[model samples]
Target: MKDKIQSFFHLEEHGTNIQTEIIAGITTFVTIAYILVVNPSILGDGGMDPGAVFTATAVTAAFGTCLMALSTNYPFILAPGMGLNAFMIYTVVLSMGYTWEVALAAFFVEGLIFLVIALTNIREVVLDAIPLSLKFAITAGIGLFITLIGLKNAGIVVDSPSTLITIFPFHSSMQDGSFATGGISALLGLVGIVITALLMIHNVKGNILLGILITWALGLVCQLAGVYVPDPAAGYGSLIPDFSRGLSVPSMALTFMKMDFSQVFSVGFATVVIAYLFTNISETFGALVGSASKAGVLQEDGKFPRFKNALVAQSVGVLTAAVTGTSATTSVVECAAGIAAGGKTGLTSLVTGIMFLISLLLSPIFLAIPSFATAPALVIVGFLMISSLLAIDFSDMSEAMPAFICLFTIPFTYSIVEGMALGFISYVVINTLGGTERRKKVSVAMYVIALLFVAKYFFV
Candidate 1:
């Protein structure tokens, strides 16, 4: 069995083994498992059944991840993306005053468009056309973006009206005798970061996974000692899992095949489809390049192996998600945690998919893993990815300028597509104006992509 598994995954060929892949998979799962709780909560706000959305979220993640694993042999995992879901509910449904069903239909159309693009190799062409420096920049940019996510989730960073963003007030008091949830969580998050850093300094195996577990254990301890009190209204609940909801699999009846296509021919629907398609394409492309770069899997020509298969898998995932009562499923940046933990091939992805399926019956336990616990791993992985910046040609202004733009814009704007779009525009324009030699070096696809982005901003 072990030999067959090794041969199937080409484990040895990838310089990895089953054990390392398993650990990497678990680490990836731990970091991303929050989606199981978060996705349903967000969709529920839009009148979708939370129970059904929970089921869809897991099913979509499992199906897309496993399909990608089988087809592409890459470790990148797929899930309903955060920003895409927000746009679906807030922008498409609430703001536009459309039913959730219409939003799903719009996403369905977007998926069809993407599948066509994937099958025709258009998506692959665009990915291949991106400059190598921008690829590295995307990788590093994603690193910072996820790091900011970690810090924000753990309460180490908080919103500020005057400054826009600021550190959480670690010394605030609770007026009504409740715990200072934000402050304590931030303190614990900092402690977790320190613990993870210490583990890294010692060269401990599976340090990222250990950091999450140890941080969670500490939270549990604090809860027991009355140091960290549970206040659901305050957004700092208990660390304990509530098995009162039972371990049965959630029914998907409410959300299954619920798309409403009556509005498909409307002009507003076209805008929504265009928006979804663009976001899905750009975000998925960025994630794929970033993960491949981090995993050292990008070919010498700057194209990733099985690129078409990966896109086809993601597009299929998006279609499935639309029918299953969720938003577009795309490659997640969190998979970088798995790559950082030494995942090199599809075997790692396979394990993550299985874990998502298992969460169907064990949702409470998985949901019990707090955000702060995983925050440290993200922060550390972010640092690991930023190391790619060292390889960029900083002395060349044309390359360095776009790279710098992409690197900062990703985290600042909180949008991967926006960052990549601006970077591509900068890359093409800067090179075209540099000299005749530089203009000759730029690809026709790059020029086309840049122009499309400009048109999107202006007209769309």
Candidate 2:
């Protein structure tokens, strides 16, 4: 049985063993498990039922990761991405005043488009057209964006009327003995970060997961002792999650195949679909390349072997997520944690997928973990991502300028699509102005994409 399993995954060929792959799988699952809580909460805020969203998030993640393992044999996992979910709920549903049904239709349409692109050579062309510097910048930009999200969740940063944003009053609140005004949560976040960092520094396996659990336990103790006070502004009203029932069966009634396609051809709808498509493509590309590079699986020509299979799996995952009533699922950068832990085959993804399925029965316990406890992991992951910036060639202004714009604009504009558009446009214009050789380097597709982005920004 063991030999057959090894031969199936070609574990020996990849210089990995079953034990290491299993540990890597667990590590990957731990790093990304927070999505089981976070995605549901975010989607529920947009008028979907929390229970339904919870079930959908888990099912989609498991289905997507399993497809990745089986089809691509790559140790990558998929989930409803953090930014894409926010875009679905905040931008598409709330701000646009469209019903959740309409937003879901857009997601479904976007997924189909992605599938079409993935099956054609267009996907490969797009991936290859992107400059290496810009790719690194996008990865780093996502890191900063994730870290910023963590800071906001922990209440370490707060809205300011005069300055736009300011630090929370941790010191003043401590002096005045006011625990609710961001002091306690800020302190707790600090403790979580310190503990997680220390564990990671010591090479402890599953440090991210362990840190979150330990911090959650501490929060529970504080709640029981009457010291942990929740603040409404920070998106927490209680440290404890409402237990709907000890165990509940997964439900797909609210969101399954509920898309409303009547408004699909409208300009507003088109813009939403385009945004989702662009974001998913760029984000998945960055994640796959970055994680593969970390795993030492990227080929000498800077291409990923079996890249087409990975793309197809992710596209299928996105399609599944839409039908499951969630946002588009994409490859996650956190899969790098598993690779760093020595995962080299699909077995690792298989284990992670099984864990996600198991989480369906443990939603209540996982949801009980307060947002602040998970904030530390995001911040740490962001720091790890920014390390890629060291590889960029700062001396080349043409490359550096575009990379810098891509890196800073993501966090500044708070939209991944916008950052990528600006970066692509700047890269083409700057390189064209440099010389004939540089102009030749910019592909026609890049020019077309830049123009489309410009049109979207102004007209759409």
Tens digits of per-residue lDDT for model 1, 105-185: 888889999999898957656556667788788778867876787787787898999998898765455554433566668
1-460 per-residue lDDT for model 2 (tens digits): 9999899999999999999999999889988887876677667668997678888999999999989998888899999987787678755776666888898898888888888888898887766777888878877887787777777777778778998878787777878777663677767888999999999899876677788788888887887787877666746657676666767655879998888999887766776787787768878987898788988889898978888888888888888888889888999988888898889999999999999998888877766677678778778877887888998999989899999998999778766666777898899999999999889989887787778777766765
Error of 2 at 292 (Å): 4.6
The TM-scores of all predictions, comma-separated, are: 0.72, 0.86
lDDT of each: 0.81, 0.82
Highest-TM-score candidate? 2
Clashing pairs in 1: none
| Candidate 2 accuracy as TM-score | 0.86
Candidate 2's C-alpha runs over 4 A off are 1-23, 44-49, 86-103, 171-178, 231-234, 241-244, 260-263, 266-275, 289-305, 336-344
Off by over 4 Å in 1: 1-54, 68-114, 121-124, 174-179, 200-209, 252-311, 325-352
RMSD per candidate (Å) reads: 5.3, 3.3
Model 2 RMSD in angstroms: 3.3
